[model samples]
Structure formats: structure tokens, C-alpha cells
Target: MKFPIAALLLCLAVSGASAEATYGAPPSGLADHLARLKRAYPDVILDYDKTKLTLKSGATIPISDGRRDKSFDELLDEPDIDDMFAFPYPAHAKPAAPAFNADPGRVRVESLFREIYGDCRQGAAALKMRRVPWFGGSVLITTRQGVDKALEAVSRDLEKLPKAMQKYLAPSAGTFNCRAIAGTTRLSTHAYGASIDLNTDFANYWRWSKAGKDRKVTWTNRIPAEIVDVFERHGFIWGGRWYHFDTMHFEYRPELLAR
Candidate 1:
């Protein structure tokens, strides 16, 4: 069957499972993803075409590197803008067991983020930080794309939950840290100030668990659905949803939740 590119991309964007296999190829299904990026960061993304994405700052990034055989590690470490949508974010859906390597929103394009949020290594990302009230205290988040406001909204909705849920939230593990993902040199979303880690006491990380001969870490989640729901409602994608789960983490990535 044949489907127009626009309609097909829209389906991929809103569907619970992303069109990971279909959209990863360069210039193949780029339009819809680009549209979502524009919508997700309307103030920043200027325009896009089959080959490149242009930002408000007049910087252009190749939509894809034209490599179709990138290993998962390569996808994570050297992704192009198109690879960012390689996995679909199941926003508002019940938390289910992620398929092996189904870590959506983890394959980030470093250059694109550095362009959008500024490079942390150069102290550029820090310059964009603004404090947003969380629980009783405050956390520093990027003011760009109104992420600070989004976190504020998440806080307002979280406060409406019962008091018992408070323990998993207050004293956030941290936010706006200028560092790379533990072992990798790639800048973490944290370095961009667009992510927040909730209370680590209730957190469960894949790395903390010892995998058996099959090398699969058992999926465990301590954070309640009620809490996860609020963050997604405000454009945050939870790390708990990843196969490499980190239940306490959530990052702003609305492009992955265009529905």
C-alpha cells in the first residue's frame, strides 16, 4: 500500500510505538519529524528540508548522516537529527516493559542540542539556566524553550497528588549538571539543563543491577504511575520507560510526544 509522506509521518509521530525502523533512514521520512521539531521548539527551529534542519540562529544540521547501518552505540554517540526519533516515546501510555534496546529519546544529536541549549563544556548551557521551584526548594533548568515553565507546570500538577507521593519527589537527585553520561563522553541531557532527576532514594537504575549470562537487567520501577503521568503531561519523557531504566529521571523532549 502507498501512503503520502505527510500522512505517514504524522502517523509515526502520534503512534504509541515510533516508526523507528521506517524513519531512521536519512531523507526517507524526515519531513514529519522535522515538523515535530519545529513545533516542539517553535521559537528555535527555523525550517527544514529533505537534507537539513535550520535553527533560528541560522545554523544548519544534516537531517541524517545517510548511514543506515549504525550500531545502537553509534546511534547513541553519533546520531543525526533524524536518529533522535529512532524510537517512539509512549507519552501518557501505561508503563510497560520496554523491548530490549527500546530506549526512546536516548539517541540524541549532540550538535543539535548544543545548538539548541548551548554546549556545557564551554559554559554556554549554564548561561541559559533559570531556577524553577520544585517541591519546597528550587532546581536550575534551562529557560530556553520555556522548559523552566514546563517544570513549573509539572510541579503544580505533582503537588495535587496525595502527600505520600511526596517522598519520591523532594530533594531531587539533581538537575543542570555539566557532565557526560557516566562512562560516555557524550553530553547528557542534564548538561543541557533540560532534564531533572527525582529523589534517588526510590530510584532503580539498570546499571546498579547485575545482569546474568543473558546480560539483561531486570526491569524495576519504584516511581508511581501517578507521578510519571504528570511529567509526561508536561512534555517530560521518563527514563523509567527505557530498557536501560533509570526510574528517577525525566527529560523535556516534546518532539517525541507530538500527539
Candidate 2:
């Protein structure tokens, strides 16, 4: 059987840039990527056979969709399971500025999340949300997969911080809001009840800042390193690390933040 020319072309296309990250195709680093994922979330991942996975649901999902040409927008809008690891997450690398396109943990596969946390549209996900006490008040967070336990541990440590740090932690901006991100159809990590945003007064977002004439966003952070460190130690990734920085956002993505 003769192979299609399109297939041949795709093979060549993916081969040329297999090191850094590929937009549309399955990256060559599939094994290492999946290994890290399984190590991070052992509950839902179950097992994989390199090319596909037998999820805890007993359903099989392909690791790649096989397309080789995708723009940044396309990668965000439509990504396969492997595409989630296209960009290598710089876990505990530093607080320095990241490269232009290094929003590693941002490229999430919706189905993977849906499988573990349940679909938000059906309200199944929200039912798992539980309130965790923080700064003397309770904030709703997910109880699934030890999330509530992890947050409780975080709160315990946070309480020991100096009195000055208390102001930034509360009044809590929000948590467990089941809604899509503003201006995009994709749901915010907050919707999964696995993320939280601190007080808005001390927070910063790229959208509110003015970009340069060259269109590069100026990164700014003001939430204090102490608070960021506490969250990082507790298995959360900080939004201040991204090129399009958001100072007050922290999501529980342990895989991206090495302990």
C-alpha cells in the first residue's frame, strides 16, 4: 500500500523541529512528557502504552491528533493530549522572565481535566468543591484528588507568616467560579476549583498594561515573593512567571512545580 504524500510530508515536518516544541503535531518527547504527567497525577492517568492511554474510565484516548501545522491560536483552541506538553514547563527554574512563547502549563487538554474533575457544564465538577479555611475565613476549593488536603496544608503554613502578609491573602478575590475565561471559550482553571486568585488590589494582569510598539508585554509583579514562595512550596504554580504575567494567580499544578 502506498502511503499518502500528506503523511510523508507530516513526518518530515515534525522531524525538523522535535527539540524545542511543536505546535500542531505530536512531539518526539511524548514518553518523557507523559511520564511526568503520570508522576504528577497518578489517580486519573492510570496507564499508557506510548501512543495511547487506557484511562481510569477504561476509555482509550490518542496521544496525538497527527496534524503538523498549527498556529499559536490553533494550538490553544484545539490541542491533543500530547500538545499539552509541547512546551517544556520550567519547573522551579527561577523567578526570572520567561521566553516569549513559554506558557507551558497554559495549554491544557479539556478532556483530561473533564475526566478527572467532571464536566463543569453539567455541574458535576462543582459538587466536588469544598471550602478550605484560609486566613481565618473559608474559601471554596476542590476536594477531588487530595486538593482539599493540600490546600489545608497550605493554609496551615500561611498562618505562620508575618502579620503583614495577611492583607494580601484576603479578602479573597475568588475560587471555584464555574465560568469560562473572559474573551475565550476555554474555562479558567478556577472553574475546576483547583486554582485561586488572591486580592485584586495587589494583583496585576497583562491585559491592563500597555504593550510596547513592538507588541511585547511588560512583565510586572507586586504580590510579594514571600506569598509566592508559600504557594510554590504547596504545589502551586505562579502566574508571575509567564511572559503575559498575572501576579495574583496561582493554580495547583504540581507537575509544573517540582517539590
Q: Which candidate number would show the highest TM-score if scored against the true structure? A: 1
Candidate 1 per-residue C-alpha lDDT over 90-172 given as tens digits, one digit per residue, 9 for 90 to 100: 78778778987789889888877887788788875454898888888999999988899999999999999999999999899
Per-prediction tally of clashes: 0, 0
Task: Give the runs in model 2 whose Cα sits over 4 Å from its true position.
Answer: 1-22, 25-29, 124-126, 212-214
* Model 1: ten consecutive residues of lowest lDDT: 16-25
Give me the runs in candidate 1 sitting further than 4 Å from their true place.
1-30, 124-126
TM-score, each model?
Answer: 0.87, 0.84
lDDT by residue (tens digit), candidate 2, 1-259: 3668888888887775454344776766677777867776777888887678668888777888887777666788888888877766565455667777667677888878877677767884454887888886889888777778888887888888898988888878998888987779998888888888888999888889898764477777777777777787877888887776787788887766644
The 0-to-1 C-alpha lDDT of every candidate, in the order given, reads 0.84, 0.77
RMSD for each model, in Å, please? 10.3, 6.7
